[model samples]
Target: MFGDLTGIMGKLKETQKKIEETKKRLDSVLIDESSSDGLLKITITANRQIKAVDIAPSLFEDREQLEDYLVITLNKAIEKATKVNEAELASVAKDGMPNIPGMDMFK
Candidate 1:
């Protein structure tokens, strides 16, 4: 029983180490996402901070349309980036938690 407990403790420690390492790596990983019309794009880090946004000048011809497009495009890019970040975190967490099914809370 003592040996089993010790072994489990060691495993837990190893899992924690992997999780930390994954977080560090994810922090530096960037996800580039764009909109459907290619009029807007964004680069975001896994931590959800916007790095850059690209807007095509032609979209600015109509102010209202431009505003709507900007909102929609930015939303799409952010949503896509968030999904990418979640996927990455999920992959990393899965490596350490193979036995626990669908444990995506860490992402």
Candidate 2:
């Protein structure tokens, strides 16, 4: 029984190590999320850092148009970012838990 417990413990430790490693890999990686019907653009890192932001001249010409498109584009960008991040994370945890409880929000 003691030997079995040790084996289980070792497995758990390995799992935890894998999880930590995956998280570290994710942190080092970056996900670029941008939006702009060819106008406003942005690059976001995996850690949620804004790498770059650009705005086109035409984007400022029409305030209303810019605002509407900016909102839509930003929404789309954020959605894309979330999906990409989740997919990357999933790729790391291929054999572990699909969606850890309470950790769903992070994904």
Query: TM per model?
Result: 0.66, 0.60
For model 1, give the RMSD to the true fold. Answer: 4.2
Looking at model 2, which ten-residue stretch has the lowest summed lDDT?
97-106
CA lDDT for candidate 1: 0.71
Error of 2 at 15 (Å): 3.2
Q: Which stretches of candidate 2 lie over 4 Å from their true place?
A: 32-36, 96-107
Report the C-alpha lDDT of model 1 over 1-66, residue by residue, as the tens digit.
687767767776777887778767766778776667777777777767778888788877888877
Judge candidate 2 at residue 16 and give its lDDT. Answer: 72
Query: Which pairs, if any, clash in model 2?
Result: none
Question: What shift in Å separates residue 96 of candidate 1 from its native position after superposition?
Answer: 2.0
